[model samples]
Target chain A: MIKSKLPKAFLLCVFTLSIFIVPSLFAAGTQEDSSGNPYAGKELSILVSAGWMDSRYDETIARFEETYNVSVDLQTVPADQYGDILQTRLLTGECADVFWIQSNPFAIESVIVDYEDFCIDFSGSAWESVVPEARLLSCKVGDSLYGLQLWHNSPEYVMVYNKSMFTEMGLEIPTTYAELKDVSAALYAQGITPWFIPGADGWQHQLAFFQIGGIYEANHPGLYEGLNNNTATFKDNQTMLKVLSQMKELSDLGYLGEDWIGSNSTNMANMFGDRKIAMAMANSSYIQQIKDETGTTDEFGLFLLPLADNSFFPTNPAGPTMFGFKGTENEDLVRLFFDFVCETESLQEILDNSPAYTNIHVNDDAVQQHWLAEEKAFVDSITPDQMVTPVLQTGTKYTNDYWMDFGADMMSYFIGRIDANDVLGRMDANRAKSAKIAQDPAW
Target chain B: MNKRTVYPVWFVILPLVFYVVFFLMPSIMGIFYSFTDWNVRNRGDLSFVGFQNYIDIFTSEENYASGIYNTLKFTIVSNIVKLIPALFLAMLLQRGLRGKNVYRTILYLPAILPFLIIGLIFKSVLNYQDGILNVGLELVHLGFLKQKWLSDPEVVWKTIYMVDAWRGIGYVMTIFLAGLNAIPDSFYEASEIDGANFFHKFIHITLPMLSGTIMINLVFGITYGLKVFDIIYVLTNGGPGRTTEVLTTYVYKLYSSGQYGMAVALNTILFVITMAAGVLIVRGMSRKEVEL
Candidate 1:
């Protein structure tokens, strides 16, 4: 009886030990197999414009490469030539694994017309939820997601002025076009450039006209709808013509810098610091840059671009956004790269590295944002009515595609080569061309 | 006949095949596509649109006509500016001078440097405010003479011609030097014995001797100026408002905006112009050669 009891106890102990040891062995094996990164040894390439990524993505991209044991090939092209390069690459089926576009709500369709053919559908991606609903329109066509827009929420293309200088000059921020002209005249009389429009940049000077879209829409209700539906045209719009005329007046008066058409924004901050120019159109974040680069102690403030008696905020939600290429052989690696960048750690790295940006406009609460106090105050000061609609370029379909052309036309008008109405008419013709290409029924 | 002197027809086959595959095929395909409603929207499915693209090119309010006009203007002016100076420089350098090789090297340096680097340097130098050129003028009390070299439409084309000449004169001079070198010294010696001056010799002997080289340079320069992009693109980007816009820039804009058919149509028009110009130039030069 004693021997039988001993055997029973031994058997029970052995069975219990087996239950723990076997599961532990299987769990260790599974962990080892699953933890092996699938993206290891793969390479990912990204094509982007210079300022779009800059050094802001270096840390995040480095960490991504380290984590996955891979390499990232970043091809940066000049901003002016980026559109042409991107178009050629996409058409030739030689696009990189990742590509970027200056995306707006209508850009994915209007700019990259064949998004389905070129971009990978990230519809069900885990990172899809990380993008905010407003930005999703830029990232998606219908229900299919194709881009990830990690942009700043700073007030872009607003009037950034030296507050201290304005105070010293006994000048108040101009709220109407007439006051703007008065202030400009006063500044010009004093031999100081009132506004430093960098027309040589080709894209910067157009903000005066397009950033006042709220004023245009307020004057003509359903203007955006009409423009989109082809019931309206940019031609013969009295407000726009007035705005163009005002711009031409500013150019003619030489208040828009000495040879503004030849001036670029390279030394704009220095000009602000030296007090050579009182104000210029720039992002709210540029105030910090001016302080940092110029080491100026002067207080800077943001205001609405006063043109054509306009008092409206530039309600623009547009920025450079990235997409995975559909033709990439390493789709899994591309997906992993996207997922890696959207992670909270990577988001923090990106935000920290971005000196030009104040905050990443994402839905992630864990991601720490560095919103500047002045930028915050500027946003808070905007009235509800001021934020009427998106800027003209982003609001209308196919409008932003011809931004450079429109700027050129505006310059032509300024130089007395083309009339204001011809400038507006040219815009109408451009929109029609784009609409025809887009096959928009409205046109 | 020797086998080397009487080559087989297969000798031309390989090069012809490559030419067709690489050049002729793409050009033909491009011409075909120009007639279609090909765009970014119609990727993988292009539809024929007859002469609509051409019609748009001509009738559109985009001032493509101005672009064509600018192209012709640039071709003519750029060649004149470049060829004349290059000829003079070549003649000067061909004669005995101190450190002629060094001068040649110095002159050729701009041609060797990439257009992008030259553009970047000159853009800074030509800037309206704080640029070296304007500042230098001010230092010398010649500030009144300083004009907006790049911004004023009146001065902008002249500025472009200056920059183009700077980069291109050396290459043209080098070619001219080669032509000059090929001329026997005996012609100049005989002309010297005839009491011929520099102008007389240049007209009678140098001009006739270098006709082939001149024709070559003209063909090269005209094609380059017709397809002028990098210099203008880098300097003014067809601006102070489209006063500087040429056909290539317009084509680039069209292509960038995803209007493939229109872009191709514009290029086809350019191709036609280039070919016509080439044929006329070569035919006239050949006729001149026959008369000589």
Candidate 2:
């Protein structure tokens, strides 16, 4: 009886010890973590825009979990609805542990002026090295770095054509605005819509005119700066009016497809697959999506849009960047997660998983790039003359703020409710509205 | 029993408390927020800016005015479009029609299906060039009738009404059926004995009896129409140049774009419209009750 009682007493003591010591053990264990995080069992939630990041990052996530013993709940909202959902959550004060914003220099200040309220300051993070100076301008506001944009350098928002289609028709890629018109006419004569602008997309159609901002700025000189300062206006800008007219001409001439205004990007792949449309404005990676989805036989090629005799690239450096919510319960965990993502192995895994991406712009040398031969070949084919200035929408103030309005005005122009100059005037008025809201001196 | 009679006012207190907390408080708070400069950038640094947002809403050239107009139009048109056809279908199914249960089930299926699924399915079916609707029309040599159902501003409203009716009519019919069942069979028999024809029976007995159901449908339809966003968003996105813009869609745009103050103001306006409509409908129903 005494022996059994002794074992029971020992067992009781052990239970009591466990009750007292288990939490202390955990606390002590996390105290040793070097990344300034002591919440090992905690979770970090990151909300992202869909289609911006591919599934290849799953490996990196798993590895990060293994290394840190913390879970990362990466929720990617659908691209179209993301903005609204983010805003609603933010307003309701139920935002996730971390969140992403598509920011530029002006965007962080203009769109998310309350970034300091929500942002976890990363002014001196080691990961800042990977971003180029031009790109850094978008990630920073004042002396603080609030966003990390590791976007690929690609030929963006330019006219992508079926190279095989051009070759089969014994035609060369058009080099001038008049040549584009001639090519379009020839394609139509052969029973194909030469340019398939999915106006119903409400986002894609505007790129044709907006991405050719180099020509407009070159002609007007200080046009964007003037607009930013409120001294210049989008209305009566000669080059912009010409570009808008040219777009209208394309729509009117049946080159932009019969029902271009009503068409969505959902069917563009099928249209290309079936050889109904010869070209569209898209990113270099989109060719892969088209080929994979439709199994199209036509090989694709990129060309600069011939608006205003322009030869500039749309260097769209904008992408989702993570920021720590100030109100998060596990702020330490969030910081650790960011540090883990910047590590070489995790970054490499992310790039490796992205089959659709050619490269991930990062400062770490260990992360390998997966640039395809075709992409390289396309880059090689571009002459120095064609590599003009970057488009000015992103760098300037209060311009990207009116993206949706400009799109609507362009649609109005297409539908004949407004003229080309009126479309320009609307942009100016919308800018003035934004400038007033911003309390900018330019207005 | 007389000795045991008590006021029992405590029974009302719980529900009253719940209503004040959940419904009344939030509504009052929403109205208060609308009057202030309560935006995302301010981070709850609210200051009263009375009627500025309201003024901006009305004077704004962007889709706000059209959104209000579309909301009113949809409420009127959708109710008429759904309620009348549903009443007739309810009448037909009440008769000795063969396979009525199967028909009812088939009709009601769309009503119970998720709105997201309906929006997705209809978007495909209504595609301009190769959607099944257009293709079917072409196959039957009715190609001329085919239009860009979701894209053409002229016909987009019609398509929205059609899709909404397809989803809502069966539910309305079911309600009408319940009303039809509640009406005494003896009233119809007495009408028949009085030498009343089918139209005469329908006018004298059916019409007066089904007024409750019609009122219910109007209330439901109006509320639904006022709050419509998902179907239009999935189908047209207030596009072909905001031609299909409505009040809720406009509110959604503002909210998503981080204009919380403006969004709240829009919602307050919608709430006022819905509340006023609801009160009027209830009052009308009550007056009809007294008359009956």
Candidate 3:
């Protein structure tokens, strides 16, 4: 009996010790190689615009922090002030370890003209292969990768209208510019706001003109190439002039909301829910947002922005992208962070966390995409040929750099302070200024 | 006097160093940068461009000249709107009113609030379609008087002046109140015994006595008006088609868009204008004091 008891006691002691010691052994075993975990105690800082990162990156950033035993300092600035703040910080050499830009093919060359001096070249980074081919233009400045763009491919800046409201009014969806005008007039006659232009936002009103790049390209043929190579100018562009004139006419006729110029988008979703406005320019995802915010079962649908009789899609591949700052002390950590965010788990976590987004456009098949049914149907309805290159702002070389200036010019034109031709001329002058600053050979 | 007994030169050394470093160095550097082709593209490697930035500011089709004109207009008009009423209010509330402290607190309240908060509150209050001001007018059967407070170019400047005055009058009155309090009651009493009316007493005793205070307010108000950015930026953002574009707003736009050299040139221009105005006002006030 004593011998049996001694054996049982020894077994119990071993079992208790295993509970504490085995996990430690496993933790020690899983410790990465010295080169792999070299940045255990370092910190990484990222500066971004408000909505760019939000909480979608929280889970992935937390996972990365756990894995590397490091912390990430995320600094978010208001959208309107981000450009000025980023430029100032960059000039002062006090920029964060990582910074973001709303990047396109020409953004690195035009927006951050001193890319070589400021951006860390991630030419041979492991995560390069994860990005899609088309997105490479935004991330690379001539073969050298300077940014990491992980954004969705949702239908952007289309006409989102209340389907129930249109049906209730017995109005068919407008397919042409003339039809749109007629619908707007009918709605205006009914004492309803036909179209809502939140001009106070300073950025929203320009989409009606730029999103119809297909119309401009079809009319001018080599317009994007000409604009880039300095062979053509926004000045005397007949299609653009027509679009601007039509927009102003709508404003003058009061088809747009009364005091639209003085109004902002704070109450836009509520207005849509209450049926105060018929249609507005927004992303396809904003339909979901409106439904969610108002808890209204109002059926919303997307249509091509019918300005200038445009039937083509606004194929904007541009989005806010991150870049590693060249002047950071923790280069290895920055690279690690980049790689970590591209992992399958991290990608999935980001997509799952982003309630505003439905999918993440990436080349990896391991990541499951959550495409909304409404967006999918809209995408399917557009013809293959009509899905052209990006909108005018993102397609052209330096045009987007002056988006705010063009918006201001458009406002000035609307108020009769400046002529329509003068507005176009100002855009030309702005493009020339950007070309000069970039030292582009085309200019 | 023994050399040791003389005031030590070190007494002024720290402040002199601070002034040179903080104020003088930055001003000189700003002037120097205005002469170069300093921009975001070049960053630290700026090239000498002579007066190209200044020429561009004046000659460019962007209507920066209008901005300069607007700045001067705002300075003169805004000061006139505030100073006269502020003086009258100061005298009215100087004595003989119940709840004068309450009135004083109410008036001084807006001065202590940040420009950002004031802008946010007033922007909402002044909205055209659903704003309290227009809505109240509509409810009172005065809908015809409801104007587009921020959108209409014809009325936007007037609206801005109103808002500026609303935020500024109380503070200006407070300064005048301090000056009013400093005056001995004997002068006013003596003037009253001499059978002088309120206007006559104001012109003679109050005006002459408060000359120093007026000069101080004038200098402060002039500088504030010329350097005005927050109010206009928060209100119209130099909008309704650059109708309210002031020098500082233009300078801000240029700087934000990476035209650093041109921005500094515009600032240099404003600095010169402000200095000239200050000197002229000081000299004029000094001459008046001597005459008195």
Candidate 4:
């Protein structure tokens, strides 16, 4: 009886241990999702920005899952932390099957230096036709297409203001830098913040100064080309200093907001909703976001930033691009997913779901464009002359690489740690460092 | 015929292998990489840039030097705040305090809470505009004392130190309590016979006996303070014009910006500082033990 009992006890112990150990051993292999689909045998993961991919993609993803007999694992990280996370995963050789990049012509070579190593060469894929020629440059490295960037040609990073609020506060749509200062004072007098720049947002605040690349380049011709060649410097530019000081003047005067340094973009929509601030710099899509998320009844409109007496529009072609991981075991499935997203039905569904977006920057004939009425009105208000200049970050060489440092420099300037010229000098130094590291011919 | 004996020093072979593989090798490699230009652009093309990265760290006119100063400031201040208060609390709890276990548990709870949760909660509580801390101060008719907690460069470090002490004091106090409990009742009895007063016994017996524990806490606290990241990140992210920027934050920034070589160099410096401090602490404690 004792021998029999011992055998049974040992068996029970072995059985219990297996239950705990086996699941963990297989944990990494079993990636699941809440996505509804009949085919759930294989798994696919996509990395995308927070606001870029609309809800219409859900139906498309579900359809792809059903047709391809795979489960799509959508891992959407917030924009602020996206770069760090994506870089870590890519470098560690554990990248998602289908990853993303806010790629431009230079980005593929500069940012993803090992595109051929990690990216699946999608050179002759049928989906290549749907991407616009200008945007096609963003997705290709050498002669091979390695990414697909299908984004809108809408006005981006433009100054969006509450028109009703401006009228109520007796403020004008500032046409020049001087007029902007006067208008800010007028709004501040009425207990309204003139502009809401979320400086604490690691990425957004610097857009005010950097987005006007046209004026900077136009004012000093060959500046962009010179910076790329390492011959030009951002240091001690009187125009940039003027812009920084203007920003500082506004910040110091409490026209940007009472605690602009501590504020984040998370409360921006709410600020617009609550009428706490008169205006902010945002993409055209964001006006829709402000209305939908905050349910604000305030009428909002867009205007060119009154910087440098310049009325240039930012024609940024760069948007989030999808690339396949060459290291992925399921390369076929990844290719299929990209192809599937390019289909007419899927593209239409994506557009329908994207209420914020007016249109997708694609050449697909079947996909119906859905530009918002407000965006159309805003575009109509602008002249053709104002709609041509490319925004600064994407337009210049090695500029985006120094964004965080520039933001920090701006903060330093605001708090009086560094002068306006010093801030510009730091930007030049950062650009030089990046240029050196990149070994760009311009440097 | 000679009698031969063999001992199993092989008993430590597995653990030693683990220590070398996980700790020693990576540490050595980190230092090695720090000297090379090993960034994202040069992933497959590493070149030796001996002392260049370090030179930039030391000589660059940027805010890197201020980070070193801030890091040192935090380490010293945090240790003093945690160690002194912890020692006193440990003594109090050892003195037949009511609900001693409950107090100990309460004190230790914050130590176990994750830094992410603690940071988020404290950030909200410390907000100047609508935070509970300011509201409470206002209710008490002390609105004058209410100030921008995280936003103000002058008060941000103090706020971090206070939050850190609040979370860490309990853990340190627990260690001291263990040291206190280990002491024999006979020591106190003999002291009483000699008519030693409270301070007399405390100075001669308690403190001397707690030296080992104190040394251990100091080492742990110093290393932790040196590598502090989450609290500063979640509260202010080394902001308000880099007032609270530390070595770790700089390293993090470099890593995030894909400056892997510079990032590794900063961490390598931290590692050296930590190891040096650790050796000094252990040697000092051992010498004191021999003297005692």
TM-score of chain A of each: 0.89, 0.83, 0.87, 0.88
lDDT per residue for candidate 2 within A1-443, as digits (tens), equals 89879989999999999999997897767655746655656777888877666586688778877777678888897555666677677656789988877777788777666677767788888878867787787888888987777676667777889889999998778878898999999999999999999776666788887788777777888877777777888788888888888888888898998888877777877888899999999877667767877887779888888877777666556655667777788777777777777777777777767655667777767777877666677778877654555566675676776676678778878877668887777777666655655557657
Clashing pairs in model 3, backbone N/Cα/C closer than 3 A: none
Q: For residues B20-101, what per-residue lDDT tens digits would candidate 4 score against the true structure? A: 9999999899999999988877777899999888888887756677888888899999999999999999898888889998
**Local distance difference test values of all predictions, in order:** 0.89, 0.80, 0.88, 0.83
Please say which candidate is ahead in TM-score: 3 or 4. 4
Checking candidate 1 for backbone clashes, the offending pairs are none
Clashing pairs in 4: A151-A361, A228-A442, A229-A442, A229-A443, A230-A442, A230-A443
lDDT (tens digit, per residue) of candidate 1 on A347-386: 9899888777778988899988888899999999998888
lDDT of 2 at B139: 100
- TM per model? 0.92, 0.87, 0.89, 0.90
In terms of TM-score, which candidate is stronger, 1 or 3?
A: 1
Off by over 4 Å in 1: A1-37, B1-4
Docking category for candidate 2?
acceptable
The positional error of residue B191 in candidate 2, measured at the CA in angstroms, is 2.6
Candidate 2, residue A166: lDDT: 93
> Which lDDT tens digits does candidate 3 get at residues A1-443?
99989989999999999999998787655655543776666789999987789999999999989888889999998565577678778777789999999899889877777888889999999899989988888999888998999998899889999888889888989998899999998888888898899988777898899989989999999998899899998889999999999999999999889988888888998899888898999877778888878888889998998888888899988888999888889888888889999999999999898876788889889999878789999999998889875699999888888877788888899989988888889888888888877777888
Error of 3 at B190 (Å): 1.6
Could you report the DockQ of all the candidates, in the order they appear?
Answer: 0.54, 0.44, 0.42, 0.49
Deviation of model 4 at B281, angstroms: 1.3
Ranking by lDDT: 1, 3, 4, 2
| lDDT per residue (tens digit) for residues A285-363 in model 4 | 7788889889988888888887777677777788778899989988888888888889888888887777567688888
